[model samples]
Target: MSDDANRHDPAPNLVLGDADGGRLAENIMHFARVLRTAGLPVGPGKVLDAIDAVSQVGVASRRDFYWTLHAVFVNRRDQREVFDQAFHFFWRNPNLLERMMGMLLPAMRGEEAPEDKPELSPRVAEALAGEREPERPQEQEEEEIELDAALSVTDREVLAEKDFEKMTKDELDRARQAIKRMRLPIKPVKTRRYRADPGGRRADLRATLRASARQGGDLIWLKKRSRRRENPPLVVLCDISGSMDRYARMLLHFLHALTNDRDRVHSFLFGTRLTNITRHLRDRDPDAAIDKVTAAVEDWAGGTRIGESLHRFNADWSRRVLSQGPVVLLITDGLDREGAAGLEVEMERLHKSCRRLIWLNPLLRYDGYAPKTAGARAMIPHVDEFRPVHNLDSLAKLADTLSRSESAATGEMVRWKKLAA
Candidate 1:
């Protein structure tokens, strides 16, 4: 008999037999199911890891088992609290699920809790039950809440509430699922090329002679084929400074999707300096691709040196990437702490090299945004377009902007150029 069998309690009808072992396994399966419902990816592999963890630590001690499973499953800071609450509630006792069901019933009935409710859990239960709900003073406030709630409400609402910067380990896993399913529409730009002319103004002498030879020296008309221009290359330079970290990460995910679906899309990341992440992002898996990019980029979340980085890019990579009139995407907040002199020169070089330069600034999400910063002033004049990139709506607008030929003519861009002169 195992050590746990000898110490098994008889008062609560506890026994350590094959049946009890099966029950434990069943509870574990239920635990994994609850975790999955809570937006954690508790797949069979993670379940197996949980089982191994339980065996290694022994399930005789409830606290030890709780922490063991936690170590195996919970990853992010935000997820830890949820997982902890779920774990406690899930494994409370034989009547735990019944208690949770009872708590949920009050929530379903929309009954308000008494003002003098005791304990934090019951208060949480009351709040969850829609008791004393905060009133929105304006229709706009309610609309915004409704919009947020409407986003993937049936799928994973908890994960959606998590900010990209504040995601926990398990929440990050759930976030990846949403990110992987995100569709990025990257349109192709056609470029000029040569082909055999089908109906040229001048006759094709070689083809005419070959056709005559085939027809025993008799004159025979021949048709000619022609080649046409193809799309311009897509070059992306994403900023990874402290201000742009979240936007950059999300954009990288979009770029990864684009790179897989499109051709000739080059991606680079810059914070303190330029790092070519085109090859790294080519990986089939987004997580693996991001891992490779993180490994390659040494200046993540560092101070912004846009001018210096652009200078380096213009000096080393411009000729290679800017050839054939590639369309350039400059994703940054234009909060260059590196001053404006070097940035002005580099921005000018970048503008001259590319067919068109589109600036994507997350700060543009604000209604009253202006190019008042030194960096924004220096770079705005050189860019062909300036666009916002913060939320889903903006990202959708970005796809439309990239597809259309309409140029960016913001008052800020025009005013900045005059001020610089």
Candidate 2:
């Protein structure tokens, strides 16, 4: 290799502690912390690795630095956008330091800054904002304690109805906490298996004879058996496409709670492909579970291919998860990229396979919502229940609905279809 080629080729591993290496390493550490705050799952070990990688490469060029950190920090495709945004704001922008300095001054509190910052996602915004704990006077603290207790109740009521898209970072945290406390109060479905019941309607002749034998043929006692009742499995097919991203994360928290509360709960996430994350959600810690899911899923925040995804589910997963008349919760907006091709067939099959098929669309939160899309129209006819899954109130309603013995009627579907037409 020529001398010019050697300069461009670069060394295999970055050497540490160059002239400006210490300052660069500090910036890298801070940047890693920022990413961790924004929900990227960046750890201290990753931070050190990133520093070392950058040290070897030398951040003489901006592109080289960006790619170096991106390779080290971004683990999932969904995190790419967030990482890019944070990178530009943290390093590339010359005015970010000026803005930070401006924010610290007491006089700048009411004054509008000359430059406006780009809006970040709720998670990112929350991480970058960081936590603040200020000292309070004893008298003021007591007043706040009394006020906070009353405010918490009122706040919960308000949060129940608040839309996921409209919620602030603090509100989102409260919503997650609320969802974690939620439980599904579903009625058990009777199975083919029989269990001995003293007052059962069906008499078991063999058991009756055995009872008589026990009594030495002197007396007879009728023995009865009843169908065993157990909580049916729950299968959730959630859409994690770009459009459903905000609602999906909240719903995952809800799913984690449900998984811990019940038995035989299966979860599959789909964007352009289907991924079974049932094992991932079984983690005891919500953060750890979500992190596992983020690392395991490949097509997160991608485009929607609803028809294809459903077709894949029906063909591959229906037999395994849809046994014993399990209740299916289909969560998506029903916007198919292929114009609802083959959706009707797959939906009909899914409806027949499961005892109850519930379509939970966040769009239904709107008062005048209708099944306007082709995908929505095809799916509306097959679902036993059509409900909104946007807020805590909606989820509570869903839990109540499932607990009831009676499922939703076909009339509701007719009304929706007519409205769509």
Candidate 3:
């Protein structure tokens, strides 16, 4: 057993349920399982630590008990909200079954009581709404069900096209796994630097002489070199504001894949400020990397200051990270709190700094999306490409868009520009 298990508990006789002190430990284990099911990185170790912490601190004060578990389990800022919701639902009442049934079927209690509903995080909501086995009547016999389909679509196809925000827990898990295996087939761009090649148009007198010197100054062979080729640097500027929380979380998985698969990839997160998370994301373990990124970024799920954040990037980081014809992926909803003050100038400067600026907006998932926001209007004209980024299909299309040598002002962007103009 571990040290936690060996340690003596102060609340040895404390019994919240049928069991002795083990009841609390069992409850903590179940909570950890729920968290794992809800996409958290909670493990058995954390559960043990939580039990030990509660035992030492004593759950006399509910607030202290809550924070103790939070300190042990939650390692990232994004996870705090989910943990809070889970704690509220899990420990609200002594009767877990009654509380769950009450929340799930509020209509059964007549219309008198205004439903005391909480705005739960999606992961926590799904976990709390646990599966229920259907009850069968004694008189009923088992029957076979049949379906006649006119058309067919595979689950993978549906999942690829489904919006990230609308995915269930299972589907989201599959999508994360799919994202981990995704690779960007980026084409290499020609550079001024040269490398050794025999079939070169330009003659290399120096290389030819150096090779001939080995053969006693004999001019038996000719040598040549070709310009070096490399994939352009990828600079991602992701938005982590309140409105973008859901989509941003999913995109982080995609970004993690990109960081591991490619080189010269720089990532930045902006809410009210800009944060360079390239180093944090370099960890091979996606869960650990995201945890570190969350701990490092202070302004997540806050208000958006697009203009100010972009201005900061332009002033401090553009020259450092945006050199050598980099392709910039600006992931945002384009909602700015400052009404896009100086946004156009900064956007233009950023556009000029990079070879290609592709703006990925989750709001584009809406059929009636319009660039009515001041930030959108100012930034749209400066970006080379504008695309939807709400699904796996869209991300696949992004890879295609990057591979081809096409005009930046595509049809979708042209129409939007005309409407904004």
TM-score of every model versus the real structure: 0.58, 0.77, 0.74
Candidate 3, residue 348: lDDT: 96
Put down candidate 1 lDDT per residue, 133-188, tens digits, no spaces. Answer: 36677655444434454435654655554445445444555565566666545444
Tens digit per residue, CA lDDT, model 2, 43-158: 98999899788778866656676788888998766677678766654553434444433444557644433245454455554544562224475664444433346447777799
Whole-model lDDT per candidate: 0.69, 0.80, 0.82
User: Tell me, what's the RMSD of every candidate?
Assistant: 12.0, 6.9, 7.8
Model 2, runs deviating above 4 Å = 1-32, 43-72, 84-120, 131-151, 166-174, 285-288, 407-411
Which of candidates 1 and 2 is the stronger one according to TM-score?
A: 2
TM-score of 1: 0.58
State residue 53's C-alpha deviation in candidate 3, in Å.
Answer: 14
Model 1, total clashes: 21
Give me the runs in candidate 1 sitting further than 4 Å from their true place: 1-192, 196-217, 220-227, 406-421
| lDDT for predicted candidate 2 compared with the true structure | 0.80
